[model samples]
Target: MGNIVSCCSLDENKKYLNDDEILETFSNSEINEFKKRLKNNIQIVVLLQDGTKLPCNLQANFQEKTLCISCHQKVKNKND
Candidate 1:
């Protein structure tokens, strides 16, 4: 497992894009649709440098445009 980093911190992650810094051709309606879908939940596949595809479930804060990574753990049954 890798170390967990805070996405909210600008100092921690310099890759964060400011509102003006981001260049998007999407219309307001399209952007709103994306935000709406994100609120429900979205599955994103990240392709690593080594060619590994990692699937992640995420939710977003519309105001901040920030993401919250979701993780689910499976519990083992003692009777099994």
Candidate 2:
């Protein structure tokens, strides 16, 4: 793993999206494109910490200003 982009916090048991950081990681336009794809209900893949690319559905919550990604299989860290 390069750097921990984002992770499911153990305490909250919630996935954290470093929106600002993620935007910086990729082009801002790319982020917007992802949003568009999500709006279209297109399935997308998210790269996990352990270098696993998982297929998931992107859910955007405007109110919360967050992206919720759901994958069918369980995701685990490489160390695990």
Candidate 3:
């Protein structure tokens, strides 16, 4: 909606970011952040190493060694 920014490549992905740094950590924080972002219509996206883009929740299990999600269906990458 905001000019349709693209996350088209794995190289464009961001470095590992822990939840404490910028994301909403607790339940209340998560709700508040979601509400605030929705209210302001802010865009939040995630680009995985394989160039797959998805809207990630505030807290996700990304503790795996490589931070990879082998998504079979993605609009950005279409791995399958």
For candidate 3, list the clashing residue pairs, or say none.
none
- Pairs clashing within candidate 2: none
The sequence of per-residue lDDT tens digits that candidate 3 reaches over residues 1-80 is 57757767565576766878555446887877766655444445668687767664343332442222233344653556
Predicted model with the maximum TM-score: 1
Q: Each candidate: how many clashes?
A: 0, 0, 0
Q: lDDT by residue for model 2 over 1-80, one digit each (tens)?
A: 59996775475776677877656778779978977876656688888776788888877776688877778877774563
Point out where model 2 deviates above 4 Å: 1-40, 75-80
- Using lDDT as the measure, the top candidate is 2
User: Which of the predicted structures, 1 or 2, would earn the higher TM-score when compared with the native?
Assistant: 1
The C-alpha TM-scores of every prediction are: 0.45, 0.38, 0.21
Indicate the residue-level lDDT of 53 in model 2. Answer: 83
Q: On a 0 to 100 scale, what is the lDDT of residue 11 in model 2?
A: 59
Locate the minimum summed-lDDT window of 10 residues in model 1.
71-80
Structure candidate 1, residue pairs in collision:
none
Ranking of candidates on TM-score, top first:
1, 2, 3
* lDDT (10s digit) by residue, model 1, range 3-68: 878656446655776776564657789989988889988987666566666677789987887889
Q: Between candidates 1 and 2, name the one with more favorable lDDT.
A: 2
